[model samples]
Target: MKTYLPQIERRILVRPNQTYGILNYDLDNAYPQRMLELVAGSPTAKDCWNKRTKFIAGNGLEEKDLGKQIINAKGLTIAKLLKALATDKALFTGFGIHINYNADFRITSVSYVKFEDIRMGDTDNAETADKFALYSDWGRKTWKNIMRSKVTFLDKYNPEPEVISEQVCKAGGWEHYKGQLFYFNPEVDDYPLIEADSVWEDFETEAGIKIFNNREVTTGFLPSTMLFMQSRREEAENTRPDADTYTGINIPTQLEKDLGAFQGAKSAQKIIVIEYEDESSKPEFKAYPIQNNDKLFETTERSVEARIIKGFSVPKELINAEKSSGLSNGSEKKQAILEFNDNTAADRLELSETLAEIFSRFYKDINPGKNWNIIPVTAIAADDNPGIKAGNAINELLQSTLPRESKIAALVYAYGFKQAEAEAMCL
Candidate 1:
């Protein structure tokens, strides 16, 4: 008989730094689609996005009539829809809106399509071409689920897969392709796609991938730290020993075995009894403690979290991150918050505009040849920094030797009111 020994495995580290070949990404490929789906489906990510969306949209629609339209859409609420749309854009850089209309040429509902389930053909828009092609796997359950069907299990030998269906929207009617049903909408001819950001696309890079990566790294901190053993203890004889020596803890073999037996037991308290071979000698206990080094981990976690917050353009203070500077005072912190809001203004404006366009199109489709305008979603409520500054200026003017009319004029200009109104208030 021949005996064989297990092969020794060696760890190898390869430095491919800046030497790898570029990888290409397809806009229509499933990788990006799957990634976006994961982000949208993740409960944590969903919550973060929902809160952020509400923060941007603030409460709900500013217009009462527009709010009514959203309420009528039963399945989805205005706030929830905005949150989904914002999350879609944040993760996929683009989102789709599907407008549903009633038979009387009135918009009855509005819905959103996840980027993953959307399939677009050669046409730029889904509704533009008379016979434009668009596919949605909304109700199509995976083949694996169908294969294990209790009713069809007996037919496993001849498992006939269900045919995939497609729908076509004609000029003013509907058509089905391979079991798909589509209704044509002549009022609007576009797929209502909203892109959150525009940037260069290359083989190894994407618009939102960096942000998602940062978020992942930030969230991994706790799990990674869980692997760190924070402390250790050693028991040794009462005699002094040289610090540099390799002497091990002095414990009797039997006593060590007993300690090992308590590996995973948990109780309110534990007592250990050690007996010495010398009947006259008493057993004593002492512990030499060791602490784990975690400065690197703390620094890395904070750095990653800051990067994540930066990617979202969210204020660090909002998330309770350590203050960037020593400014612990409220006024100083307010400035930081104001700066963050200012930096986010552009992105918020873009989201509002995108939402406005979708709502406008829905209104137009609902009421053809009617003059109606939908109010655009407002960005985060304006900060009162300007108002505070105006008040300070007014106080300064009052302290000066300027005439009453001059003060009133300054107040009128600063507060955007008529001179008479300012005088009346000042008086």
Candidate 2:
């Protein structure tokens, strides 16, 4: 037996290099980069990633101005920062924020950093990383030279104001002190695995299947066909005696060019005109009756898609609206949204808390007491009236003993009426 496919081996060996004083993310130091490419190549993975990012970000902060405040000179607001963090978190399960401080050690500006661009500095302790290395191209494919100016060293985020103040004072100014980095990794002592890491091989498999189909189509779907052509007497005689007389290389070369012309969709229904002087020199196409595996390919692709979506914890109802219909469609999607919201609540809370902590130090107006909540997906009225008609639900609400405000709330949420319309009907 022989194997044509590569064996799957997923491991994160955080090898430390004493020479560079930086730890390698996997053996090649390009795990995140490779993961990024995988996500880009797989449609299901990319869709789930976008859905996760959107769900985690939700409707932005409850306090609108707090999110509107520009965090950097480039006009990157807190909302954009939250979205970027959510994007990275959805993909890498970790995110980084570059914080710049003034001479007085007060946070001046903050910017979102690509998680793939960051590498942990070599540390004796396994639990904590004191420094980080930020380079645009960790794979070194974009910038081969990797100049000293391209690399930046940043201190890990220290919450203690007094410690940062003292360090800045010792350095003589903020100019002397490099910026700080707030790296968020839910897992301790190791680089966090991507959300879809468990089904990562499925991503590759899906991509390979697509490539196979593409090649089949491009080559005129001739994978099962073998062409056998007899050599002409004159052509055989023309061959030099010095050359291998048994093998007619020039005959195969011309046949290859003829075969190449029969490739692509344009060749479909095209007539093949082969001229031969006798039956002995006729061309024969022997097609081995290979099993048609289109159904198998489709099933495998669907399984791969489902696994990828499951790995991201996204509901099929939310991703595939076409599969749902009738009265249950809206309700099913609504329930999925609610369930997914609950599943992603922790992610939302993590972003909220991280932002709250950082902003509390940067802005006096923003504090932990102020709610830093990312608004969840609200259920629409259509979703609320599952088996019941909208008119019946509204009539029942109108006849209830509930107060005007309560009735209005029911009309808005349960019957899918706009706030103003619900209020008017209640009045």
Put down candidate 2 lDDT per residue, 220-335, tens digits, no spaces. 77667787876544332335675675554553445455667877877866666777778778888888887778888988998998999999999997777543322352667778
lDDT of all predictions, in order shown?
A: 0.41, 0.80
Residue pairs whose backbone atoms clash in candidate 1: 166-180
Collision count of model 2: 1
Write candidate 1's Cα lDDT for 1-427 as tens digits: 9999998642221121111111112322234443445435433333334445544444454444344344234557655666666565554445555544333333344565564444333233233222212333322335323121221000001111231111213222322221121221111322322221111121113224445455544444222221112122334343555634646645445555555443322421456566455534544444444343245544544454444444455555555523222113344446545665455445455556655544553434432333222233333333446445655666677678888887788766655655555676456
For model 2, what is the alpha-carbon lDDT of residue 119?
Answer: 84
lDDT at residue 291 of model 2 (Cα atoms): 74
* Best-performing candidate as measured by TM-score: 2
Best by lDDT: 2
> For residue 152, what is the lDDT in candidate 2?
83
Off by over 4 Å in 2: 1-10, 125-129, 143-149, 165-172, 231-255, 325-327, 363-369, 383-427
